[model samples]
Target chain A: MAPSIVVRDVLDREAVRRSVDTALADFLAAKARTATSQPQLGYLSGLLQDFMAGGKRIRPLLCATGWYAVGGGEDPRSVFQVAACLEMFHAFALIHDDVMDNSDTRRGRPTVHRTLAEHSAGRRGEEELERFAHSAAVLLGDLALTWSDELLHEAGLTPVQLGAVLPLLNEMRTELMVGQFLDLDATGGLTDDIEATLNVNRYKTAKYTIERPLHIGAAIAGAGAEAMAAFTAFALPLGEAFQLRDDLLGIYGDPGTTGKSRLDDLRAGKNTTLTALALRGADAAQTARLRSSLGNPLLDERGAADVREIFEATGARATVERMIDERHRQALAALEDSPFPFAPDALAALEEIAHLATVRNS
Target chain B: MAPSIVVRDVLDREAVRRSVDTALADFLAAKARTATSQPQLGYLSGLLQDFMAGGKRIRPLLCATGWYAVGGGEDPRSVFQVAACLEMFHAFALIHDDVMDNSDTRRGRPTVHRTLAEHSAGRRGEEELERFAHSAAVLLGDLALTWSDELLHEAGLTPVQLGAVLPLLNEMRTELMVGQFLDLDATGGLTDDIEATLNVNRYKTAKYTIERPLHIGAAIAGAGAEAMAAFTAFALPLGEAFQLRDDLLGIYGDPGTTGKSRLDDLRAGKNTTLTALALRGADAAQTARLRSSLGNPLLDERGAADVREIFEATGARATVERMIDERHRQALAALEDSPFPFAPDALAALEEIAHLATVRNS
Candidate 1:
């Protein structure tokens, strides 16, 4: 058997990203060409192409790494195609998410619904235009989802490979939707339940964003149980830390850097671990202040500042920082102790990813 | 080889509906049972179950007939499972469609979003509650879509059968979304583009609701190109006729029988073939009256009556009826001339279904 190590190509993040992007572009171009009867499809495909160009490619990178970590086959073409499928699926999730949050912009540009609304400007009354845009955006998201499945089907996996991958993909999708439902249900209401907040983080970010991608790649490589378990051990804590960092950035990061308003979570009253910690530690007066200001639609920067002050005063911010630090350490430790043999370079790559995930601002 | 004729069980529509329902019920029960940590999933599953109970099971019936029409294997179990998947997919489509249309009721009950909004009546302000319900409903729809895929995966089809069906399913979903986009774009305006309206009908209803379901089942039975082509020949006109009948029913059917407000399509300014014909034939004063009244949100019985009068005056209603009749005849003729060598019972079932589809009140 070939050495059970990811090749140099899979380990190179830039190379993987480029290949995945090429796969996506080719698939979408084919779709546009075939849809001659529906010019609207070409327009939507263009929007998707533009929307996709701005992503960090983190999932695709991780997927490729996971495949190599388990000593997948020599040719990486199918891996790249599968990675592109993941990216397309992510596009679907984000488009619907923007519509759900009524977010105005994403990646420093207008959201899909906002762009569509602008496209129809002057065609109808404001309310009708908004309705039309939202509906069209939803349809566009649905198309992306279907197209993602097409990408997977066309990826040319053997029956054995396809069988191994389908269940994991199904679980990941269902888990993401469940997490979304939980998050939507919990929004607009302040909660002091840190455990509940972390639960959401696990399903929405840890499993969906980190663990499953790794598991999928490993499965494609036909990794045994030991490697799969080791991935979970390393992935969960790292994934949580990743989201914890995101929670911090959502409040404290620069808009120019994060490509979103820092105030959105506060205004949406997102029951994040940070906010839950603050609520758990607050005194009566602080609790009252946090409750009133967090979910207020009119919350301004001054209000955000007051909320931040309370966060600091109650030690929630510091505690969350410590939590991130501990989880990051735990992830690195899991990687060190894992039974699955990894090449030296694969080990180093994973460590580098862990740092990037937990320590970044955006 | 077994004769290519569907057995008695496959011909029995009521039995098909029962088996499909059982499959759906069993699958949802497993979902609810496994989602122990998320009680919200249980609630959503219950809602889905209730929602599913009211469906006519037309897709499942067509799927079974299609399978037998191509002389599938003896056991009908896998076909039932696949039929259930189609029904589940239809649920996903309807739930999202309600959100897009902002419709209040479906099947004589509150729409999914409306039901969810009522469930949270006292929890948030009116606007926030609406937002929450819409978001949650979209998530629920997403879940249903995911679960439908799960159903297909779990169905005990050989890999070859799966390979045959996946492309057809993908095409059906993409076509449906494209049709939905066109329909949304055309709404809120009066159009005399009869061909465009028919094109939308071909994709949205004819192909998605009729042709694809039949093709998927036939593919599962390992049907060849000629048989597939025969199904299409029989399905397209029947499907168009079905939608044409629906357009008339939407405007003229009784609320008691249709279980929906007839004013909904008019209020939404749906650009159906019936409406297109009306616009094509109306005089200036009649055109102005139709345009003003059709899309008026507050349009009541009196306004609907005026619109109906204009429809009659322009002979739009008569033209639509004649169109349905002509297409229905074409569908029957195609079935008669097909060379696929269907069993006598299977042919009778298709003929019965064609009659039911075009001559229904609901």
Candidate 2:
């Protein structure tokens, strides 16, 4: 189950680009032709245009890595269809998530709901904004959802592969929805149970974001049980670290560079590692003030700064950073312990991912 | 490509039931072991426990028929997976639709959301009630979605057969979403265009409800292109009639029989056949009243009564009945044009379905 060191430099990016690009192009074309013989869903195929723009193809690369993990020969093109499924699935989540979180931007552009809300606002009154956002987001999510299945079908996997992937992919989708519910439930309810909150991230974010795609790719590549077990052990801790780092970025990273607000987590009062730390570290007086001011739907920038000051004073930032490093160490340790096929180049690239996720400015 | 009458009858009933039971039971058991496993979903599985209770099993039956139409053999067991997929998908649609429409009851039991919302009301606040309903509906939809893929995976068809089903199924899901959009878009938009309004139902409801399932069954059955084309021709009209008949029932049928209020459509000012007729036939005052009251979200029994009177006066019910008859005839005529191996028994059974859809009584 040794993975080979195939591409060392980014100059080999064309291979990865073609993998995703070919899928996207063929997907759009095939979708365009569907329902034509029936003449029902006129031009509905075009809903995909804006929804899929500018993905970095990271998921596809991860999928390729999963395939590589199974002692499978590299057929870069063969992984494209699977890669497309992962990417499309990611987009599907983003569409629904934007509505749930009321996010205004994605990547560098307005989120789907926000864009649609703005369009609705232009033609209508103020109250129409949220309603338009909800309605539009729902359909857009459906569009992304259907597109995922279509891409998966076109992946050219065998019957055995289909059996392996479809159920897992579908199960991933279900877990994602439940994970989102678990998260929303936790947000609405609470305990001192930090583990419960983290479980939400594991199901809601990590498994699909990391594990399932890896599993599907590996499964398709015919990874045996032992190989899968090793991969799982390596992926779980690494995945946890990935999400924890993402939460940190949400609160502390430069807004201009991230295309997201640094103060958003503060304004939203996300109960993340830093928030949990601040809560635990706060004195009675500080706790009351923090509790009273947090989760303000009407948060202003000044109010946001007030919250940030509390995070610093409470040692929350340092606590979260320490936790992040510990998890990262744990991730590397897991890889070392597991019998993963680590080509030197892959090992380096995987390390680079850890740095990019945890240490990069954006 | 010729379809047999005996085949359609058998597929329509016994085989369809077998598929639903086998696929659902086996799927639920397997899915429960996944990491995303839900103990509550087992309890919630009761929500679907009686799903097969009252359903005519028509869609599942149709899937088998479509498989046969596409050159599939009479190995009914082989078509089981596809049929399970059809039924699970329909169940998913139904559960979500009840939420969207705010239906209080389905199959004489409280709708899933209503059941949850009501249970939460006294124990929790209004917010909890809403969240419970929304979250439960989302989960139920997810369960149905997963079960569908599970069934498709086991459907015993070749990858090619599964591949064909995927695109069509996705298109149907897309159309259903688009139909939902079109329905919402028409909420306060132009309702004067009866044909346009009907297109939403045709695209959103009819195609998926009857046509696609039939096509899938025929496709899985290995019906050739000519048989498929014939199926498309017959199914489109028949499917349209099926919905049109249901719409009529919503306005004029007995609540005791339909398990739904006859006045509900009128109260909601639904843009169905009767409403369209009232628009076409009623005077200016009636039209203005209808426009103002549609989707008012407050119209009561008396108000609903007035709308019903208008429909009767305009003869909307009778016109729809005439259209239904014509549609049924067209569907039957279509079978004559195909080389479908629909043996005499199979043809008779399909014709019987045409009768069932259009007939006033059982």
RMSD of each: 2.8, 4.4
> On residues B1-362, what C-alpha lDDT tens digit does candidate 2 reach at each position?
11223344444566457556766776665555453454545545555655545566777766665665454565566566677777787787777666556667666567777876765566545755675566566556656765676677666777666666666777677777777766655544326677876787787667877788877776665556777677778888888888888887776677767777655455444576556766888788888777766656677777767776776777776777888889999999998776656666567667877777777531
iRMSD computed for candidate 1: 0.9
Interface RMSD of each: 0.9, 3.5
Instruction: Give lDDT per model, in order.
Output: 0.89, 0.66
CAPRI-style class, candidate 2: acceptable
Give per-residue lDDT, candidate 2, residue A114. Answer: 76
Reference-based TM-score of each model: 0.97, 0.89
Q: Give a tens-digit lDDT track for model 2, residues A210-298.
A: 77767777788777777677666656666776777777778767777676776555555556656666777889987876776665556
Off by over 4 Å in 2: A1-18, A33-47, A54-56, A69-74, A121-129, A262-270, B1-15, B33-54, B66-74, B119-125, B128-132, B261-269, B360-362
Model 1 agreement with the true structure over A4-72: per-residue lDDT tens digits = 324577878788877888889998998898778988788889989988988888888888889889887
- Give the range of the ten consecutive residues with the poorest summed lDDT in model 1 chain A: A1-10
The TM-score of candidate 2 is 0.89
The TM-scores, chain A only, for the candidates as listed are 0.97, 0.88
